[model samples]
Target: MTNTILGNISFENLAREKAEYPRLHMLKPESFKHIEIKNFEKVEKEISFEIGYHRGRKRWCLDIYTHRGIRCDGEIKFFSSIPAIREFIRKEYQREPILPAFNQKSATSNFNI
Candidate 1:
């Protein structure tokens, strides 16, 4: 899979999109595109969260994909404003999401999480 940097973490096959979530100020919109996660279906599984503006729909949406589990069930949920998105981000990422370095180190290490 392709790899992209998000703050100090590297996500596979996801590109950082141009957007901003002021509530989630620590998380720069440009650095991280998707949230890489693992879950359990019949067994352990991996997935991602794609959060951004839907140009066609003209709304904010969160796409959870590639797995089925307690938290991520491969669904697309929409929101009306940045505050809603921020709440969701904070909910899903209670303590911040971090993954092992994929291939190379990220350019920045200032991310608190």
Candidate 2:
């Protein structure tokens, strides 16, 4: 996949589109899963979120990939207001979670038990 910098676009345009035109942020690889969001975190300086699907041995996890390259696993509590989502993004970016890939292979290897 290509890495597109969010810095190339205007935040106002992204925010307006995210607010007015709700869309499903499909996980990467296209076949993983689809998540619908009526309202999304408004894009801002030094802040961005990535949506992707993670596969485990027994189940799949929907993860939010942060700008810091950390993936926050499990269910996400979405916010309807732009400001709220923005704040969540800020805080989450600070405490970035490790990507599930670290444990994926181990989980599958031990699945026969």
Candidate 3:
């Protein structure tokens, strides 16, 4: 069971297969006005959050909001391959190395991204 909203929200269910910056309609718009794939673009929103992948660091960073925004202050960072990003979300950054599932041919699991 996930205790965080990120864990609760399904990126695939949001229907963002083609969107470079995927977002969702918040059930309760209070916490997250909007959340999308973080990029270099400049966005204008009161409660905007971003999730990005850093190739250099080989990790993911989830920045909640800017200093001028409503959130108090904080950021979540973790390392995950493009395929394993789901695990990062499911585990909420507390991820261990994912081994192959049930003698699968590859390490990648069948998580619908």
Local distance difference test, per candidate? Answer: 0.46, 0.31, 0.38
What is the full ranking by TM-score, best candidate first?
Answer: 1, 3, 2
Kindly report which residue pairs in candidate 1 clash with one another: 2-13
lDDT of 1 by residue, 1-113 (tens): 32344453333322355322211212332223334444632344454665655556666666666543455456778888535655776686453434223233342222222
- Report the poorest 10 consecutive residues by lDDT, candidate 3: 99-108
Per-model root-mean-square deviation over C-alphas: 11.6, 19.4, 12.9
How well does candidate 1 match the true structure in TM-score terms?
0.36
The residue pairs found clashing in candidate 3 are none
Clashing residue pair totals per candidate (backbone < 3 A): 1, 0, 0
* True-vs-predicted CA distance for residue 8, candidate 3, Å: 17
| Alpha-carbon runs more than 4 Å astray in model 2 | 1-21, 24-72, 95-113
Which is the winner by TM-score between candidate 2 and candidate 3? 3
In candidate 1, stretches whose alpha carbon ends up further than 4 angstroms from where it belongs are: 1-45, 66-73, 97-113
The local lDDT score (0 to 100) that residue 25 gets in candidate 3 is: 24
Model 3 lDDT per residue over 9-63, tens place: 4222223344333232233222323333458665444443445544355455444
Candidate 2 whole-model C-alpha lDDT, 0 to 1: 0.31
